[model samples]
Target: MNALMAPFGGWNMPIQYAGIIAEHNWCRTKAALFDICHMGEFIFQGDFESGGLEDVFTFSVKSIPLGRSRYGFLLNEQGGIIDDLIVFRIAGDKVMIVVNAATAPKDFAVIRGRLRGGLFTDITAATGKLDLQGPLSRDVMVKLFGEAVAAIPYFKFITMNILGVEAIISRTGYTGELGYEIFIPAEKVCELWDLLLSDERVKPAGLGARDVLRLEVGYSLYGSDIDEETTPLEAGLEGFVNFDKTFVGKEALLRVKEQGVTRQKVAFEVAGRRSPRHHYDICSAEEIVGNVTSGVFSPVLGRGIGIGFVRPELSAIGTPLTINHERVSMEAVVCDLPFFKDGSVRA
Candidate 1:
């Protein structure tokens, strides 16, 4: 139960419990329970268009079927990302928006400013979220929740009663593993956490391990890999943007697409155990091309791996690069996404 604590998104949170590497390995092989209550959740009720909700994000809100969720972005006028979020069609006239912990306040302000109608409420304080992730997560969830838990597919969700309260059990997660994110009333979350941990297959993981897991799968960290200065196109996430839809940043994005993005996000694998740290210089032939955004000594790969933004011409797979910071330098190679490819995310 002893854990290393650190400050994150204005909350004192656990950085690690048993250990970061151990927890990361456990999440890859078995179920790892993460206390993710710090994430922000918002509820919107009203007409999707009349409330100005349909035009708020890069993806189409009205097109999402009920009981399903869609991942996309909110952007500024210059097409810079405001926040990357997931929208859930919880009911006919109601939807839930889940966003990053640190960007919650700003995201709320930006979203509310754009909305001319609708009842918008921040439900983060009242909601508690826990991520149960790993290859065996499906089996563990089915045993505790019900047979229905096993039936939920990727990116889908269903409301179920747990601990005498209605909860949303979504088959979605950040780790590249078969997982579920459970949202329940704040008061009952601890009870459910305790009950889940009582099972032998589940262990506690923390933000430190979570970071490594997400990065290994090539998922961007909002503040690190992508931020207000970056657009989805530049981040290689054009698939999440629907240009046919009218959005706040559509014009700027179109312009960027026409002119071409100056820099692009790239994933690389280090040749050794030396970890690449944030802000480390990425170079080719002794010239700096970009900087590392997120890096770690990957337990699964047994080597250093990192994500960074580089000139578009330098992002090709198999390109040789050097990651340098002060006296530290290491060899790296531009590689295809998902530095770790054996995950059971879709299996």
Candidate 2:
């Protein structure tokens, strides 16, 4: 069990088992197994309206059909997001909430404080998550679980028996690749892990490769690209925030909408291989505008790509810019997200 370590969201986690590039390529071409056991999960069984669960998240939970999940933020009273999470509508009144690893405790406290009744349990320890991702993910699931998994649409999940145990297979994944997040009892997780790895197509990948993959596809990392200080409007994620329904932060967001946002999240590409990193200043015609929040070397693009906060006017596509750090400077240009468009995420 040789594992290299790296820092992630205040936790020292495995970067890769074999190597980053090899694991990444394996996931792209064949199949890859990822140990996502660090993520947090909760079970909430109660009336959506009466338990105050409906008013908790930025999105409506009742609207999510059974076997489906919705992604959104949980905001504090100040319109600041406490954490971003996904709610799986497992049944009529039973929902499972998946949250970030680091923010699990905070999210639990916030939700519990808001709830009046029903059973809410933090099942993080009892839950172990493994992701199987690749162009051939569907083939693997279909062969292993049956056609039910194959027919499941994107963002939908199906609870079925795997290895003689109940498990949930969700079509949603963080990596911009065809993948499934398999949630099973913690005791049985290692069994599934070994089962998936027994196939010649699957390899083990860690958080490092997953980050680069997600960022390359222009997906926002929870704490990096967005936080309590930034609203969905400013973060370019208003699509997840339903304006037609009401939530805790609706008034603040609506007020901000009326006035317009000052700083907006923008994706950019460096002119060369020199990657712009976090806190690197972004300049336009030598005038400072914003700074990079997340940046990485895109293997597919063979160049540097990043996302940053900049003046709304300067956050347009093809805007010429320069990224400057302490002793490193690089030429960059604003570009649309999903720098790599040919992902096999859903193929």
Candidate 3:
């Protein structure tokens, strides 16, 4: 397990084991194990209504049923996305909020400031998260954990005994695969990792392969594709925002909805194998209209796939664009997302 380690979100993380492309391909065909213990986990226990938890996010937390999870955004007063996170309803009065590693501190502060009565506590130091993702992930998990793991539907979870401790196994993932995200005590994480890797069907994947896998499925990266300066409306993620709910950023989003966003997120494919890098200029008719946020050479499509923000008029499908950076240039065209669509996510 001699992995190339690098700094990510203030933690030393594995960037690759064998290679990025090799791990990416292994995940597409078999099972891939990801050590995601760096992510932040918060526990909130109290009344959903009076505790002020329901109005903190873009979606209604109280509406989430027991054993279910919801994905939404935490927004600032300006309608800008603070972070994209998932809320898991563990019980009637308890929920676990999972957030990106780098933004965890600020997110905790922001959420705490908004709450009036809920008992909120940061559990990241005591918790560990591992994602088992890929087409064969379900089979691998069921064999190791038991048949109960097979019954958990997408966005649902169950609390069970594992490694002599209570663990939560959620049927959720970032890779758009039929996978599971297991939350266990930090002390037992290493043992669980070793146990999972003992199976020949599972291979360790690093952040590099995770990045490529997420991009192929059109998932936005927190720091890159979406950030504090970019509102969910401009990022083409307004669907996650519930207008019916009274949230912190509702007014700003309403204003944006009325005035319309000048720039919008667009998915594009390069004409060849030349990958579009972040910060590359996105041009239309030789005019720089926007910039690339995230880009990668997609092995599935055998082309360059990118997510960028451009003038609304230039975001339509099939619209011609040119990505340029210094001396490098590549022809591209706006295309639908999920450049690779054969994922076994819902299977």
Candidate 4:
């Protein structure tokens, strides 16, 4: 392979050009860059109802205001998530759906199969994504893309000219900070990367750093924290689901709600340096309860943090627990999510 490759989601991807921790620290103090070309972007060019796009997700696509985006999931008949996505309503008949990289092909096929009418196209290869994230993201974007970039509100986006080409800049990101996700032409992505790096405050970051950033803020990793076997209600993600709309998994979710969840997602923190990891057994005393879905060593909190599933009764603050691996065990407690409370996510 011509490009650097490392393991991710059973695929080899680039780890870094410089280093992971170097990139991580840069994002915290200054601007850290990211190349997200592996993400999937799809365009649906038809009215929400006519195209059957409105019912595709748990929320109404047509109700989303113009130039704004909403995050939610596509569910199967059993109420399990097909994928988590952000939908940007660019125009009346034009919507941009951003999907995760690992589920790109399956998401496209499933979404297309559900649509009754419309011009649907998977623009993954033709589109390129980059994230310039930090407290200084606005300033950097404003400096390059002009005032239009500076005016975008949180969760809102604008399609404008960048580098003389049409591009979309949204004030949305995985990190709990002021950031922008720029969608530009595939060919111009490298150019934008070079231009953004010209600023002293901007430095390139990799997916490794991105993962840490997102996790630090309690943001759920799609495949890890959720899957086809879990419902939004059980995941503590009911805020993203619309009860007013009829969508796939609504019935299943209602049923799950009535039945009460057997298990729910919970966030916990270690009292010391040892970190929890995926599949690490969670236990109250010696009996295994659940497994850690996602975990990381948090730089901001100076402790290890993670999210996992456990019995609802056991999910409580100050509950003492232990994370167990084969020959490793760590003392942990069930603390609140977002161990790092100070963030510019909504700023």
Candidate 5:
């Protein structure tokens, strides 16, 4: 696999293999395998209440049923997002925290400081992750693994034996397709990767195709769409935040709610083939309202789709705007998310 490699989150990552568009299309029609070993994993074991784990994130950890996972944010004192991550309830008292690779160190330190009694450990060096996504993903997994893989519902996971070792197969994915994220031992990742690609229906995809796939479905990229300076409210991710929970940033978020958000996240579609790039100015009329956070030419829609922050008044659907970068300019309009809505994500 002669993949074009690039630096991402302090690691040399594959940008594309074959071609970005080809790989993206393959994933839409068949299963696409992704090497997601760069993601960080942490294990926490203790009492949710006594260990102070319940208040660590925007969602309640104790309330997460066993064998299920929940997505939410970790906020700083100012109510700004530190990172958006998922917590998997592995057992009654043990949970696994999955986070972005680049923020692993900071996320671990912050989480440790907040905990009083839980036994927390960074398992990134020992854990490996792989994602198989598309409408055919479940079939591929079932054939390779067992019927157990076919039983997992969305957001649920089960521990099963693979390659003579325990592995977690979760029915969750970044692409808006029926898929699974498999967590296994780091030592066996190479073997697992080879095994999955051996299937004729499965093709390897790189981060380049992965980015376009996620953006098409309106999934926010960590460093791009949401970051430490961006609050969940402004990012339109407040649904993941539980206001009843007494989290670290509750007071600040309450304050923000009262004051209202100054800017809000919006999705837009370009009128032509011209792509919008990051940092491109988002203009309403003649005034620049915000900048593009993430943008790409969507193959599914045959147009450019982007996610960016803009003034609230300029974020309504059908609001006309201009995307400008240096000498490049394109006409665009605010649109609903999931630009490609006919995905098999729920099916």
Candidate 6:
């Protein structure tokens, strides 16, 4: 396969297998397999509360039910996001923390520093992750792994034997589709990847398609949409933050809540086929209000869709705005999240 390659988070990754739009459409209608082995995974074992893991993130770690996962962020003292990640509660004394590849080293140091007592180790090198996503993903998993695979619900996972090795198959994904993320031993990833692709319904997808799939569903991409300088509140992700819990940035977040955020994240749709790009100035009238963080020409919606940060007052629905970059400009209007809504994510 003559795949386009690109550098991402210190790894040379496939940007597209066939083409971005073709793979994106395939995921919406059928099944798309993604090699997500470049992500970072860490293991922590010990007492969640006494080990200081409970207070490390914006959410309560010990409160997460076994076999389930929670999405939130690690923040600095200033309430800025360190990284948005997911915590999978594997057992009473252990949890798996999945983070972005680029921030793995920093995230490890920060998390280890906060822990007073625990057994923590990086498992990224030993683990290989693959995501099979689309409306028909459940059927494929069930057929390949037996009926047990179908029993898992969204946000939940099960430890199962795949290719004779224990693997974690979670009903979670970046794409807005019914999907499963399988974490297998590093040695077996290629075998399993090939096995899944052997099925007629499954085709290999790449980062390009994954980005479009996630954006279409309004999911933010770390380092692009949300970053170290952006707070959850400013990113319109306050629901993931547990204000009731004690966290590193709790005080700063409270102060922000009291003072109110000046700018807010907003989703908008372009008037035509013109796609907005990152760093494009978002203007209201003649003044610049914000900048585009992520954008794509959506095959699902047949228009350009984008996300950006704008003044609080301009974040309302139906507000007209212009996305400008050099001489390129496009008309857009603030709209509801999930430009494409009929996804099979929960189905």
Q: List the residue pairs that clash in candidate 2.
A: 177-345, 178-345
Q: Distance from true position, residue 253, model 1, in Å? A: 0.6
What is the Cα-based lDDT of residue 271 in candidate 1?
A: 96
Tens digits of per-residue lDDT for model 3, 142-225: 888899999889999999999899999999998978899999999999999998998899999999999999999999999999
Each candidate structure's TM-score, on Cα atoms with residue i matched to residue i, is 0.99, 0.97, 0.99, 0.96, 0.99, 0.99
List model 5 lDDT by residue over 16-63, tens digit each.
998999999999999999989899999999999899999999999999
Which residue window of length 10 is worst by lDDT in model 2?
5-14
TM-score, model 1 to reference:
0.99
lDDT of 5 at 248: 88
> How large is the C-alpha RMSD of every model relative to the true structure?
0.6, 1.4, 0.6, 1.8, 0.7, 0.7
Clashes of each: 0, 2, 0, 1, 0, 0
Per-residue lDDT for 1-347 in model 6, tens only? 68899999997888999899999989999999999999999999999989999999999999999999999999999999999999999999999999999999899999999999999999999999999999988989988999999989999999999998999999999999999999999999999999998888999899999999999999999999999899999999999999998999999999999999989999999999999989999999989999999999999889999999999999999999999999899999999988889999999
C-alpha-based local distance difference test score of model 5: 0.94
Whole-structure CA lDDT of model 4: 0.88
Q: Where in model 3 is the C-alpha error above 4 Å?
A: none
lDDT of 1 by residue, 1-347 (tens): 99999999998899999999999999999999999999999999999999999999999999999999999999999999999999999999899999999999999999999998999999999999999999999999888888999889899999999999999999899999999999999999999999989989999999999999999999999999989999999999999999998999999999999999999999999999999989999999999999999999999999999999999999999999999999999999999999999999988
The lDDT per prediction is 0.95, 0.88, 0.95, 0.88, 0.94, 0.95
Deviation from native of the Cα of residue 285 in model 5, angstroms: 1.4
Candidate 4's C-alpha runs over 4 A off are 1-4, 7-12
How large an RMSD does model 4 have?
1.8
